[model samples]
Target: MFRTHSFVLLALMALLVLTQCTSAPDRSTKDPAEAVDVADQELSLTEEKSAGDWLQEADAAANEVEQHSALIRAANAFQNEHQWQQAAAILSQLAPKKITHHSQKYYRLAKARWAAEQKVWAKVIEELEDVATQFNQREFRVLSLQLLSQAAYQQQDYWQSLVWQVDAQRFAEQRNTDTVWSIARRIKQSELPQQRPNDLALAGWWRLVDYHHQAMTHPDSLTSFLNQWQQSFPNHDAATLVDIWLEPPLKPSESELEAEQAPPEPTLAVLLPLSGRYKQQGQAVRDGVIARTGEMKNLRVVFIDSEASDIESQQKQISELSPVGIIGPLLKDKVAAWSAQPITGIPQVYLNQIDDEAAQNSLTNVFFALSPESEAQQAAQKINQQFPSSKSALVITADGSSGRRMVDAFTSSWENEQAEQPTISYFSEREDMKTTVERSLGLTDSQQRIRAVKIAAGKIIVDEQERSRRDISAIYLPGNLQQTRLLKPFIDVSVSPFAEPIPVYASSATHELRNRLGDSDLNGIIFSDVPWLIESSGKNILLSQWLELRNGWGLSLARLTAMGYDSVSLIQRLEMMNRMPGLVWSGLSGELHIDNSVVQRKLIWATFSKGEITLAKEADNAGSRYR
Candidate 1:
């Protein structure tokens, strides 16, 4: 009986051990199928939950772990859908301490992305500055670094931004070498430290930027400079970039060197409507081109009548000539048509600007226009500079397409600079101008108040009216010469004697040298115009030629002549200007520069004083006036 009882006890002990093993098996030795089942269950839980379902789950979660997980999922889902506000709301509910250890990094990244969307750079830096280094995924790591770089750039910490961009390029699938180079360029040479940084990558990048700056003026030394740089930074990440900068040295024979020194003269094709409605304007441009190339033996000029019946025949002729560059299609429609069918190798300079989105992206096509809009933008900048303390402005433009464009440009530029929108008024006729000016200055309201007081007294009273609104600090007038002549007087008279004199600014359309005697009405108004029209100190080499042209073909046509001259001057320098930002070419049309394939002109500022135009005192002080 005792032996049987002992055997029964051993059997019971074995059964107990088998039950325990089945209930909780060792995880390391668990069956692969069972482990996969558990993982599938967790994934199914996540996949089943929608953003709304996740939010609901978060609210109903019984523990901190479940709540945090649910909230993170909800925020991420909303973020993926670009529902930023909803994502922000979801993230705001998450407690930092309650977030799961694995989800903490992702939560911070989501929050930072939301901040970036809101343009809150400080918040982005605050959230990502510490957590960015923890990301193990290449994509997440790269994104974090890029966000940090962009945030730093927005905050004007360019050095830090450069550091972040370089780090990103190291880890990213595709290197952002151009972006790194561009950011490095923004750091001024003067701002660079006297002592090189200890970071080899950063120091190498700085040296590269310095090399590029030196190469802009002295390209011949680039190969030698690049070789020296590579030797200095042999193991640096930018060592590979040296290959891009290095050009093969030309070992030419004496004859080859001579041939290179004096290469074949380039032929330039000029297309203009020489015999149609724009005959006079086209002739002026042709004459201007001839005048500019009269002394040049290295260039050949050819003219094509753009308005001729056989346009395709003209194109064939253009191809046959094999001109190095083509400049023309002055009419907007012609420019658009020419831009549609671009010549693959030859560069084109359009005389008029087009709004076609595709044309703006063409590498070989340049849009150069004597744009009144450009003048309006400069006028806005000039006003802001001259009147830094002025908070508000009034834009008085004529009621036309040109005037509307001027108003739009000025308003856009003014708001960008001041962070405040200016008031705008439009006029159609002479009476409209008077009424618009009076109403804009609050003179009409003042007169009404005076009449109201007289009516209240029920008798005629000689009571002076209150001053015009004092809020307006400046006036922008964008109009033609006739409109300006009619509008300036009304503005001068409408202001109450008690008010401070509001300075008036005008666009180039308002200025004409021949009409200077009539500009007595335009006195005290500062306007932007080309150097050819405003400069008479014999500084502009083309000023004499411009005067001669103006005497023969009116001021209106002479301006086109100046455009033609500038177009020719820019042809050879376009490539250089495109590659080098902030490079200025002193041209007769204006201070010419290129940005994104568009040649922009920075006009000189001049003010009418006693019916004569003189460079604005501010412009003269800044040395922008013709010397």
Candidate 2:
């Protein structure tokens, strides 16, 4: 097993440089073939001789003659012994022209592989490009292209990566029996398409992939884009290929969709603090609920002022009204007070989330809120889902209870998904945010930077040397709009601009307010929120109309309005959801699914680019830098 693994390593580390070391003076005067034959015999007797013994014999044979075959044998033995540098050294010693074509190809590939291991990306690309352009064998060419694709991707030059994959696909298709098509398909499907100049094939292909990616989140736009692409690129092969995705989504049959189930309770009651300090919030909730239920024939909703000073008095008045199901009491204290009691015979949905340990555990009724924790969890989930390569996260959060909970929720959710535990840092003041971020990201390693600089005897030199840790693949900041805006630039400047950009993820708190100038600074930060807030598709007919009528609304209040809108529909389906655990209801808030009376909302995502907030699609460009 060790030998097999070693052989694979040797195959990959095949070397390429033009330089060669002169033969040793005491080298044997035997024919090159004779030396190789002896080495081959020693390799064959691996069971008799230890790997160390075989390596010594191969080394002697390689040094004795300036033979390509002998040198390759020595390199193979070195690789098998896990002496990667030694194996690379042997391959480097042999001139490409002196070696057989097969050995030469492996030699060059090995050089590229070794360079990649050293993070010498330029050398890796140079060698791989040589093999890709000069190699005659299709398999070798494909291998070179594959490595080049990876190399380009690592450099974040996704355009070059896609181009290489396209070339690989063409070569693979020529062979017909090769499975490289799957490789191309995986890359195309997973990567976001970038517009390529002077390459019609890629440009056309980009449209198809872009359409497919957008369609995942916006199915309504798919058919229109499909038609546009087909019309624009009439005879392009890429256009023909899009036919596979052209299949429209399957709609539920009229009977299945309209099938009669249990009718919702005749009377739905809304519990709101209509005449107290929380009047504005309660009114918004009431307005949203009323808009949705206004046209329903068999349904009547009673709006009850739930701000009665005595908790018992409020409950008594609610019970007297005799609502089949109650929605809200949009205050945390009220929800906590009610959660202490047993179920109130009537089904209830509270619009405020309670974080109190006992209150959370005691709830029998459905608890729904625009929870910061839930939003944090969803943000972590979406980041993990979108960028699987990003395992480690560096979190920068504020030093308050709410901020701490948001970070904890994010970390817990990420870790629960079996992702690595994130590194966390905190700041108490806005003034300390930059310093906190720099320290957490290891960007403030000034001592190390000073040591890295080469000082002159008398004069100062190399003043601007900096280094930052690269292990962090993503950054999670659960701050409000201002904090998010300030921290993003600090993060960007703290790390070396040459390093690969780590993706920044935040909860809805970051993007909650619609401030163009404020959001402009938050460009490239990916965050998740309720679909109703980000998407302008009018999926929620009544809610969209409400927003249109009210030109501008507070972000906090708007969320409550959505909570109210979903509450009405969710109440109607709560009984059915309990019966069918697998059933999910798509509401304005998100894709709503319930587990243990706690409604989990899988929110939609969006990112800020060029001062505009756009719905994030499942494409590579979703996280790409603004051009």
Candidate 3:
């Protein structure tokens, strides 16, 4: 058996980073390779193994006439062989299984019953602690704790899941501590109030700083999300990262209640990239921001090119003007640089994503509103929730930044959501994703046939890629609308286990992609998005604001009016929740949730067909899906 501290840490870290080990087999061998490295290996599950093995063997003895081993041994054999009925027969004969087996028997019996009921995960974990007893199988007991975490997670008991995760992490030391810290934070983030940008930001930071170390491509995908997150946590620095990319909200202190009594047109600062490759995007944000100010009485929105401003220079310029609040600095580097500068305390909301310093310091009074990678993760979570029974496959673009981020986020999130904290947070490119998953699930055979593909995806995977595609349920992830639209036709053509053509997606879908992949192409497919189109069933509490913006500003705004209106409405609500004083938002996206930790609903599901989106239901904000 490999007794290297590295392997044990490797398994634990994997659990912490990607949230792994929900349904692995109890191969029971000390060697990780021979036996599935399940959560049952934790010391907490183990104790004085009175007659654990004896009872198990006794259970196994019911069907096999020749084999004679301890009770636990018999039980394990029967369970491994999947002779549930026979195993139960022996367990039924045991007395007070827990105490008799030194607190091992009932636990294993629980496993037997759970397995018999087809609750594979629940059974394996429940049976492990008692069977592994501390004095006899300390490692196994610890593994049980880990497995318990996995079981809680898989069963959607996130709070309990985190408790177990915390317990198992205590034994992890030295090199394993990072994993423990990271996973602990991840569990905390999982408890986010909503999928909003603030929530997504917390989620993103965990996946990156502690795991992948960077955000996704096409950072614009999270624009609406960050805005929403900001609303939840108006003064939080988590919101500031994205706020750095955009402009700060009108400072309420400056625009005091006096404006309402004798309202003057409020001067809103619009920061954007007026002279850069991102000119189009900047213009989009500018137009959206301006279009947003239509209803506000005291508002005179000014557009400033964030690219033109140097860190210190822009600070001086903005302070001189004494604008209501400032926004923009769009790029991460730019935002971080700007954030590092000590300046006036006017509330600033950057359009860019969060910076390392800001996130580390947890700065106050800053609002961040966008984070593309986090948004994709939220989308992936929704996919998992929507189809808990179906596993996903990825058929992403071989190239492109958007493709890379989508493939990474979806693939990693799917596995993490499936496993009990596997270290799949490094699932960056398609190849990296393939290798990580194949190794975890033991898809050695599949790693082979797809040699060239895996190489292209960027990994020297020794596993069999061909066999992998054959083993798991998969999703086809095209990172862009174009990629998604282009890939839709090939679902039936590509090879994977799920007989039916599975859900297809990009992290986003613009009109262009929608126009291309009309109803037929989009049917049964899933995509992530903010609410742009209005449906009769959708409760438009922000309808008046949206109508006011459209009626006053030219209705020629991009599809972001819904988001802007929602953000304002959300902010108002948070302001109302003055007692909390932090961010507070919810019920804004399909399967998306947002809270103080984040701004936008983590995800909003959309389906496309014949150039139109067909989704209407938003996921409830109360579940672990947002967390």
Model 3 C-alpha lDDT per residue in residues 263-337, reported as the tens digit of each score: 444454545678878765566555446545665555566667778867676666666565655656556677667
Extract clashing residue pairs from model 1: none
Residue 608, model 3: lDDT of 63
Error of 1 at 27 (Å): 35
Stretch of 10 with least lDDT, candidate 1 = 32-41
Local accuracy by lDDT, each model: 0.72, 0.65, 0.45
Q: What tens-digit string does per-residue lDDT give for candidate 1 at 1-627? A: 226665455334333332332234331332222222211114221245566666666555544555566667777766766666667766765567655556777788889999999988878888888888888777778888999999888865676788788888878887766788667755544445556678787889878766655554444465677788988988876666577546454577988677675555678999999997988888878877887888566788989999984557767888877788898978888888788886667878899998886678755678998877888888777766666654778898878887788888887778334435788998877778888989998988988898788888886666776568787778988877787778888888888786778898887777765664336767898877777777873355565656665575566676788888888777766654554344566787888767678998988877788967788787333421111
TM-score of each model, in listed order: 0.70, 0.53, 0.48
The candidate that wins on lDDT is: 1
Model 1 segments more than 4 A misplaced: 1-81, 90-112, 120-145, 151-164, 171-174, 178-264, 287-297, 307-309, 380-391, 412-420, 453-463, 515-520, 535-541, 579-586, 610-614, 617-627
What candidate 2 gets wrong by more than 4 Å, as runs, is 1-265, 309-313, 342-344, 355-364, 416-420, 455-463, 516-518, 537-552, 619-627
lDDT of 2 by residue, 84-194 (tens): 675675665665545544455556676776676676666767887756766665655676787777777665556566677677756663532123222223233334445
Indicate which candidate wins on TM-score: 1
Model 3 scores a C-alpha lDDT of: 0.45
Alpha carbon lDDT at 503, candidate 3:
47
RMSD of 1: 13.8
